[model samples]
Target: MTSLDDLPLRDDLRGLTPYGAPQAPLPVALNVNENTHPVPDDVAAQILDDVAAALREVNRYPDREFTRLREGFAAYLGHGLRPEQIWAGNGSNEVLQHVLQAFAGPGRTAFGFAPTYSMYPLLSQGTGARWIAGTRDDDFRITAEDAAAQVAVADPDVVFLCAPNNPTGTPLGLDVIEAVYEVARGVVIVDEAYQEFAPKAAPSALTLLEGRPRLAVSRTMSKAFAFAGARVGYLAADPVFIDALRLVRLPYHLSALTQAAATAALRNSATMLRMVDEIVVQRDRITAGLAELGYLPHESWSNFVLFGGVDDPRATWQALYDRGVLIRDVGIPGHLRVSAGTEAETTAFLDAMASVGSAA
Candidate 1:
């Protein structure tokens, strides 16, 4: 039998693992920060109609520029954004990959605060760019001054800031984005995959794009719109910054059906996003419940909660899994992260935690 060792693989990727979370057919699954709510029936009907229409042109290549989809995203983002400022891919990971390919390659470097979205370093290395992991303040917070100093020292060709960071659920401030951009020489990416779940009045890095061509804010429909299965993610940036991505993307990268469905979803953005308000309710419920159970739950602007003080994360994870409830361990010592599911699913998770006892 052949194995990886017997094949000729790139030495840089020799020991690296592909990014993924655990998969299971659990009764209550809250891992991976997915929006567990199903797409609204009315919106789903519209998407079906659009996708069916698109199928008639399946034999032809999709719009290489994806113009209409770009326009849809620009309208949805709505901070005076225009189609010229938008770029998208099958998912936000691919969107970020384009940035890496355009700006950072072998000999150049990419930087992100430590314990960020696990995919940051992986995407950087996959592009042959060296990945520099910088330190974070206590509880995984990054201060503007500290972030700027670290970026200056690393001198990377790209920087990834996971707004409302994953695994820890720590929110990034606008000050940090401004500070990093002032000191960093490279393109700065703010991955706001969960931004729709943030407070309504919270400012986004998109607001910083007007004067900073080097800054980009990426978003995805997977979380708030319940369109993860549709594989649509986009970004808002300066027109010139968007042009850089054009140089690296393949011709007709997005499929006609994908563009159709995403555009339809965007048209119904108001209805689809109503789920976010409900999810936030469950998120706060989880936070309050975790604290009552004697666990320390981090304040989350996103749709998940990362709770600490678990004595044996693996054991507790197994216990919850045994009860048909699955959450993420996220490799943080004494910590676990769980997404905000529908009300009933959230109840099941909290009940499972209570029954399992606080291992701490």
Candidate 2:
């Protein structure tokens, strides 16, 4: 029999498990960290109208510059970070790759905290940069001083900090990020993929861009904007780095339809903000409810909570799945991360936890 082994897959990726999101047949689902709200029917229709208007020009190539979407995203985020300084791509994941390609390569080091967004390590390996993960203390907390110390000690070429961190949902506050910025000898990336759900006490790292030329803040339409399938995300960095991203990304990466849909959603920023307020409420409510149930989940500034200190993490994950709930089973000893859904969904998960408190 002929083998497909000759096909060009990266040598390093040979041992990796394919990433498949577990979608179950259930009314109340909470797996991926997605905003519970779908785009309002009216809003979606309006976006289609806008996209259709632009579709007429599909005969020509898309705007390689992506000017409209870049400006629209900055206005929607309304960050002090300038639109001119923002760069868009297929997803924040792609934008991250651009950063890696620009700064990390063979003989370079990319350091990130353990239990971060899973993509960081994969990208590091794929880009031929060595990946270094620092272990966090018991509370899943790291001061900027602590991170800064790691940078000085490890001497990584680039660093990734996931604020309101993935899986753990621990928010990195401004003071901590500030200290890291002050001490970082290399480029520091603050990945705020879940920032819309972060508590006010957790300020975005974008505020530090002026003083830190080696800083980049990544954002995504996938989470708060409910555009995961749209594949639109961006990063705000110093103009020099943003230009580097422009030079690195394939020309006209974002299709015309995507630009129009993204722009339409951004114009109605109030809708996204309203959804964000609702999601934050749900996240807090779920965290508190989990605590009351004898499970110690992190008090998150993101859209999910991490349940830890379990005995057999594998068995616990299986029980939840058997009961028709799907959650991300991640990281080392005694922990599993689940996202926040509706109030009912959160309750169902808690009830399931009570059902299988014994992770045997």
Candidate 3:
């Protein structure tokens, strides 16, 4: 039998080993930063009823453009954005790919800071674009001057900013975002996957929306909104830029069920707000606990955090798993990222951490 192995792999992907098994379960699972709280029975019932009504929304297909969901999202964010300014995909991860495909490829460049989502450069390279990354200072924040210098040279076609950046959870300085937008000849995507946990004064690219046509903000319901299983993510960009996504992104990319469920959640933003408050409260508690054990996590505005040890992070991860607590090995060499869970589970995790640290 002939095999396709002879067929050449994509040139850019010839030699990279992807992260293995992101779903492997541990005794106290805290790896993915998923919302520890599931939708309550009331929310679940509403979701079911709304979905039943919306299932007949159109036998033909969902609004190929997802206009209502977009409008609802814009209103939910109170960003005054219109349907034309919005785009949705199965997840924010896909939206990241859409931006890279539309803006960066061939000889073009896509750039983001290192120790970020870790998915950005992978997506960029997949698009056949040259991917470049600059490291943040030890404090885990990137500055406007340093980022501006890279944009001046790389002149990236797409710049991904995971505000309150992943793993590190430190938001990029607002000035850095503005500088990238001001200088980049191409689009700048602000991946605000964890904005709810960020301080109110933390900088965001959303402020430059009107004057900066190339600016885009990608938001996910998976984090603060507690809609991970629903798999809904949206982008807020200039009307024209968001529309450009239509050219490359799949039509009806959002499911009727997902749209129904997510639309309902956003309609009742108060629930999400309440959940975020709980998660934030728990995050602080967990951070404080971790610190007490000499486990210093970088300042965070996200559901999870980054902490390092004097040893291999992967080993620390395996050690925790061996003890029945699952956490993330953030590929930071000697660091792991721990997400928040229920209060009881959090206590178990703290105990697990104490045991692991003591043993190490």
Winning candidate number (TM-score): 1
Assess the local accuracy of residue 13 in candidate 2 as a C-alpha lDDT between 0 and 100. Answer: 64
Give the TM-score (vs. native) of candidate 1: 0.99
Tens digits of per-residue lDDT for model 2, 1-360: 754466787676676765566777766568888766888888898899999999888999888878888888777656566678888888888889989988887889999888788889888888888899987768888876787787778888888998878878887877867777677677888899988887665567777788677988899988888888888889888888887777678877889998899889898877766777777777777777667766677778788888776777788888888887778778557877888877677778878887876333
Which residue pairs in candidate 3 have backbone atoms (N, alpha carbon, C) closer than 3 angstroms, thus clashing? 164-171
Q: What TM-score, to 2 decimals, does candidate 3 have?
A: 0.94
lDDT values, one for every candidate: 0.92, 0.80, 0.80
Clashing pairs in 2: none
Q: lDDT by residue for model 1 over 223-274, one digit each (tens)?
A: 9989888888889998998899999999999999999999999999999989
Instruction: Give the poorly placed runs of model 2, Cα more than 4 Å off.
Output: 1-10, 357-360
Candidate 2: C-alpha RMSD to true structure equals: 2.2
Off by over 4 Å in 3: 1-4, 19-21, 201-203, 358-360
Count residue pairs with overlapping backbones in model 2: 0
| Candidates sorted on TM-score, descending | 1, 3, 2
Better of 1 and 3 by TM-score: 1
Each model's number of backbone clashes?
0, 0, 1
Model 1: runs farther than 4 Å from truth?
none
